[model samples]
Target: MIDPTDFKQGMRRLAAGVSVITTMENGQPHGFVATSVTSVAAEPTPTLLVCVNRNVSCHDVIGASRSFCVNLLAEPELELAKAFSSSAHRHLRFSTHEWRALATGAPALMGALASFDCELAETVSVHSHSIFLGRVVALHLPEGPLHPLIYAGGQFDTLGSRARTL
Candidate 1:
C-alpha cells in the first residue's frame, strides 16, 4: 500500500503556477490561492478545471454561483497570494488589491497576467475535493510586466528563480 504521507510529499514535487480562484458570495467576493487550475479543452469551447477542497467556504459559493474566474498570479503578486492563502485574511483579501468585474461578474485581479472568466459546466466529487469543470466565457489580459508566480517543494516561486538541479 502507498502511504498517504509519501504520496502527498511526492505530489508536491510537481511544480505548478499559482492562481486565485474567485467567485461571488452574496454581493461579496470569495477567493483562494490555487495551483491546480488546468486547461481541459481548447476547441469548440474552451474549458478549465479547478479543484476546490470541499471544506472551504469558496466551494459552497462557487457551487451557488456556478461561475468563477481564475486569475494567474504574477511574481510581484506574491504578497497577494499569501493574503488569499489564509482564511484569517479571507474577508480582507479583496480590499488590499485592485480588482475588476469579469464578464461573468467574478473578481479578476487587476494586475494578473491572465484571467479566465468561467461558468461552471460540470462538477465531480473525488475524495475531499470537488473538481469543477468550467467553460470559459471570457479571457482577460493586461499590458504590464508579467512574472508568473508558482508553488513547488512547499514554497512560493517566481520567474527567474534559481534552484539546484542534479
Candidate 2:
C-alpha cells in the first residue's frame, strides 16, 4: 500500500474549498469542518456527497437525522472553520455565528456563500470514513460575489483576491 503519510502529504498539495457539514438532532446542532464535500451529479437530481470520519460525534447524528447542510465558507469565515474543526471549540461552533434552517431543518450559516440543504439519500462505508450522498432539497445562495476560503498545505487560505467569475 502507498505510505499513508506520503499520501496525506500529496493530498495537501491540492487546494480545496472549505465547508461545514451540519445536522440537527433533537434541536441540537452538530457540525464539522470538511473539505471532502463535492458534487456528484447535477442531472436527474442535484446530488452531492460528503466524506465524514465515522468516529466523530456528528457522524452518527447526521446519520440519524437523515439530513445535512453543506455551508460553503467565505474568506472572512476562517475562524468559524477553525471552530468547527477543533474539538476544544466544539461547543462554540454554532454560538459565534448567525444560523437558520431551510427545508432539511439542518442549520445553515447565515452569511455563507451558499448553503445546500440536503436529505440523506445513501451511505457508503469505507475504511475509516462514511460517504454520505445527499439529495438537494433546498439551497440558499446569497447575492454577492464569491470569495471562498480554501485549505492546502496544512493551512487555511483564501482565493478572494485572485478569484474571477466565469
Candidate 3:
C-alpha cells in the first residue's frame, strides 16, 4: 500500500497559483488562503471549483451564504496570503486587510490581480474537504500590469511576466 505521507509529498510538487476565497456570514467577513481553486468550464457560463477545509471559518461562511469571491493575489500580496492562512487568531488577521463587497455580497480584496464574484451551484464532500462549484456572476480586472503569486513546495513565489499572450 502507498503511504499517505508519500502521496502528500508527491502532490506538493505540483505548483499552483494562490488565491483567497472570501465570503460574508452574519455581517462578518471570512477568507481563507487557497491554492486548490481551478477553472472548470467556460461554456454557457464561467464556472470555478474550489476545495476548502470543512473546519475553517470561510467554509462555514460559504455554506451559509452560498456566495464567494475568488481573489487572485499578486506577487506583492504575500503578506495578505500569510495573514489569511493562519488558523489561529483569524479575526486579528482579517483586520489587517482592506476589503470591499462585490455584486454577490462577498468580500473581495482591494488590489488583487483579478476577482471573481460567484454564486454557489453545487457542493460535494471529499475526505477532509468540501469541493464547491460556483458559477461566475461578475468579474473585475483592475487596470495596470499584474504579477501573480504562486505557491509550490510549501512556499510562496511570484510570477514575473506581464505578457497576456503566449
lDDT leader:
2
Candidate 2 clash figure, as a count: 0
Q: Which of the predicted structures, 2 or 3, would earn the higher lDDT when compared with the native?
A: 2
10 residues in a row with least lDDT, candidate 2: 157-166
Q: Which candidate would rank higher by lDDT, 1 or 2?
A: 2
TM-score of each: 0.93, 0.95, 0.90
Worst 10 residues of 3 by lDDT: 157-166
- Model 1 accuracy (lDDT, Cα): 0.90
Report the lDDT tens digits of candidate 3 across residue range 42-126: 9989999999988876787898899999999988888888888887657665677677787888987778889999999999999
TM-score of candidate 3 versus the correct structure, residues matched by position:
0.90
Candidate 1 global TM-score: 0.93
The Cα RMSD in angstroms, rounded to one decimal, for candidate 2 relative to the true structure is: 1.6
Candidate 2 per-residue lDDT, tens place, 114-165, comes to 9999999999999999999999999999988688999999999986554563
**Candidate 2: residue pairs that collide:** none
